[model samples]
Target: MYIINFIVSIIAIIIGINIRRNKRNYLIIGYNKLDEKERQLYNEGKPLTTASNIFIISGILLIIGGILAMRSPVPNYLTIVSWGVFILFIFGGTLYINAEYR
Candidate 1:
């Protein structure tokens, strides 16, 4: 169970690093869908940096939560809460990027 969390965290961290390093707007989801003209309207650096930070931070939190779950007697609750917070972050981040960047 905790292994799954670790795997997901690692993946998220990889994605965050990729986005931060690549600095390619095409790597972003909704931003990618924007046509060239629309895409040009926004500054690239801020949104990519913000998104990358969000992913990296969330990934770290997932890893910490997983470790806590492993040592906790109530692993189930911890896992559930961890996943719930992750989901919230995902949605919130998406909304934030779309609203702020676009």
Candidate 2:
């Protein structure tokens, strides 16, 4: 369970790095669907940077939470909650970014 968290965290961090480097806009949902004009209306840099930061931060939080959960005496619910919150945060953040950029 904790191992799964670590693995997902690593993948998220890698994706964040790629997004920050502007090498993987296609990985962004709905990014590739925009035509050139719509793309122009959408400011690319700020939203991508923000989303990347969100991903990186969430990934770090997952790692830290996983470690804490492993060391704590609590059951696996802590990890489950952490993962749930992470997913919601990512989803909400992505929606916010898309709406704001659009």
Candidate 3:
């Protein structure tokens, strides 16, 4: 079960990385053609285009979290860090999804 959790967490990290990559790609492409509303959002830094940044950061956090959660000989503090990373991963995902749908 513990191994499974670790694997799942790693998978989440990979997904996050992909998301972040897509967002960056869109950003680099100048966002194609932005609607007026999208332009407004971009001006306000809300840029509802892609969740790449969030995903990338979340993926990194998950990697740390997974390392901590693994049954390795790491210290207690690492375990805490792992949990923290997992939390960030969740937050990133939530924020991305919310922004995308909204």
Q: Weakest 10 consecutive residues, lDDT, candidate 3?
A: 43-52
| Model 1, global lDDT | 0.87
Candidate 1: deviation at residue 83, Å? 0.8
Model 3 steric clash pairs: 20-52, 65-82
Off by over 4 Å in 2: none
Candidate 1 wrong stretches, greater than 4 Å = none
lDDT-sorted candidate list, best first: 1, 2, 3
Q: Say which prediction, candidate 1 or candidate 2, comes out ahead on TM-score.
A: 1
What is the lDDT for 3 in model 1? 93
**Model 3: per-residue lDDT, tens digit, 1-102?**
344445656675565566444544343224456666765555333432235555455556655655555656764556567666667666665665455544
Mind giving the per-residue lDDT tens digits that candidate 2 earns over 1-102? Answer: 899999999998998998999656676679899899887887778888988998998899899889989988984988988898899889998888877878
List the global CA lDDT of all models. 0.87, 0.86, 0.53
Candidate RMSDs in order: 1.2, 1.3, 7.0
In the range 6-74, model 1's lDDT, one tens digit per residue, is 999999999999999988677666776788899789889988998898888889889988999999999
Distance from true location, Cα of 90 in model 1, Å: 1.3
